[model samples]
Target: MTTAIGNPYLEGNFAPVSDEVSVNDLPVTGTLPPELNGRYLRIGPSPKGSGETGMSHHWFVGQGMVHGVRLRDGHAEWYRNRFVRGDVPEDSPNTNILAHGGRLLALVEGGGAPVSITPDLNRMSTWDADGALRAGFTAHPKTDPATGEMHSLSYLIRPGTEELRYVVMDATGKATHAAELPVSGVPMVHDMAMTATRVVVLDLPVTLSMDAMGRLAAGAPESGDALPMRWNEEHPSRVGVLPRGGTADQIRWFDAPRCYVFHVLNAYDTPDGSIIMDVVRYDTVFRDVFRGPADGPPALARWTIAPDRGTVSEQIMSDYSVEWPRINQAWAGRSHRYGWFGGTGPDSLRLSDDVSRDRGGSFEPGPLVKFDTATGEASAHHFGTGRVTQEPTFVARPGAEAEDDGWILSVVYDGTADRSELVVLDAADLKAAPLARVHLPRRVPFGFHGNWIADNEIGA
Candidate 1:
């Protein structure tokens, strides 16, 4: 569905697939672990039809489609991809998919309510925790391993005011608590960090702009790619630390560097009352190009916030430009030793949709990187030259004792074959060859976030 003119996101692997596929017993190259019995589910933008093409087709604002692989025993059972829509397809949740509170949900941020889907990817309907969620829900919600509760901060994408809401969903999928916090502007809080006692809010400088929305409304040429947000210089970049179960007035604010963080690897509190947050940081985003986040390459950085001193420190953990960080769910909101990331170079448009200019960023295939936060060392697994990978989901082995005792699964797209495969790697040994490769039915476009849902956690 490419057009006469060009938009980078609408071409190649980023282009949306038009068909809904359900294939059983997909081909496999190696053996799937007998203990690995669940589904590796991922969702991303998959716009329908050929009407929305060209530069106006922003990558973030597309219809969501869920792609999943079901595995049982040592067999690769099936692969399915379905649009994440209920009665109305426009408000489908497309950014992330996860199982929580006995319900499986497809999620989107910036004011869209989450939509529940069945185990087989069938659309169920809009979910609001039985009407408890009055505002929008965030795509990223940090689950507390101690209590199985999920916490998130939600805000409207097209905000007219300057406020955000902090919500806590209990283990039973009920909204336990919610509070409002006043802010400078409607900052695009893409993700938040959670510690044992606090939920850290990233109040960065990127904000909603009425001017950009006006351009899209007027049907301006090249405005098809215009996102409603821009890099706001007037907005002060800071982080808000709200105590667990505390009100907005008790939040402590500390200044941060003028940058953007799309994902937080993990965050935890130190004994001395400091917060350590690992994240993929961008120097700037939504700047000159209103299309995507191509202002600069994203680097893995750590931000240490000290409320007692009202100061924050920044340090680069890995300079190898990576994103989509995942760790063992057991270490969530706690100290962790290892994390997996997808590598992207300075080239490849730097996550930007405008490929009109020849940026030095390389289009070559990237490696799946295994990062050790304790030693600042990275080991990468290359998928050859013609292949690119999305986020790597780490599934720990049953009753595993070691932190790295698990399997890393990622969807790798091969440009040479115009196809995709699920690559499996021993989490402890990235230098070794893949343990298995599950051949998918078709190519899977680079998407946002996904999780490995075990059968015991939800069901088969």
Candidate 2:
């Protein structure tokens, strides 16, 4: 049970770790794969102070922290955690970290800019490399596997005015193209999907709070820059499809069902000229996020957007409460059979409590789930007892041939030991025994997305 007055985000396993440490030669269980030669890195919001809870506390807003574990030639070398640096209190950028332009970046949507970080897990600086990202960058920018190009659709919501930007960056990470997209009140477009020929945008019902806007104008104490985005009944939920490297004016808008999507599983074009977009659809958000999560649990669903009809249809793909969907990057912006997400079960909370600093925390990832789109079959690697998993990142073995031929790497919190470990599971057999478990000195509090940066991708 959460403390009567304590913020749910800061009280339990969700609580933030105060110290940043570096430890080499971490303890390992099982055998570390020799082919895994890179760093398993992840980032998320960590509260700068426990006192910043209550009416102002939010899982999405906090000091951006990066946690990383290095692997090379059958050994887990080191683990380091660092807070992304910026201007000061004015610069808390916690969201997702990714590799772009051959450099690693820490990104947060809605106002905080993307900050670059060293491969050794050190914060570099706020990246305006050539000044491509004028506003804010999205946490979920789609990286094209074929050309190594990154595509992003970002929205900035402040005291007044509203709009979205379409940005394209080459493999080296210089902004090649940028365009401004006009829109009504600020709508929460957290993630975007990409196909071989187009950029898929989600324009749902979650709108920025005007009441919060008014409060900010009156100089209310600033807790977070997000400023509370709430669900709007009057707003029409929709999706926008724009041709790749095209302007927003050419976008074809399609009416979508009354729902919200925080992340997309995958999307591609159908043979019949239709587009298949899979996403984690939420019933609502920011409804009561300050008190608790808004929706029960988001589910994986598929929406078929038919442009001729100007409408989108959805089908629930899995009944499981899932989020943070991932797929092989090679299959991204294209079709694939396998998909993965974090799942929860009946005894989820009970298991979470053991590792949690306190009782009564909110939703935490329970298991790593794998899905076969071709067969509609499901597989899971559940953390049996006294453990919880974070977003699983897929890493394909060198010269991998099959779709699920690599390994699923995730940061796991072991309640019994009260420490975190990075577990590696064969993607083809997620339920099988972990290939290896690299132990961490401290816990990796529940966090957002990250990716495995291969040796070649990291600068020397």
Which candidate ranks first by lDDT, i.e. highest? Answer: 1
Question: What tens digits encode model 2's per-residue C-alpha lDDT throughout 230-279?
Answer: 77888888888988888868988888978888898789998777899988
426-458, model 1: which lDDT tens digit per residue?
Answer: 999987988999999999987788888888777
lDDT of each: 0.82, 0.78
Off by over 4 Å in 2: 1-4, 87-89, 216-227, 345-361
Among all candidates shown, the one with the greatest TM-score: 1
Error of 1 at 65 (Å): 0.3
Check candidate 2 and list the clashing pairs.
Answer: 1-360, 2-360, 101-172
lDDT of 2: 0.78
Q: Which ten residues in a row have the lowest lDDT in candidate 1?
A: 356-365
Instruction: For candidate 1, report its TM-score.
Output: 0.94
Q: Give the clashing pairs for model 1.
A: 56-224, 56-225, 346-361, 347-361, 347-362, 348-361
**lDDT of model 2 at position 197:** 87
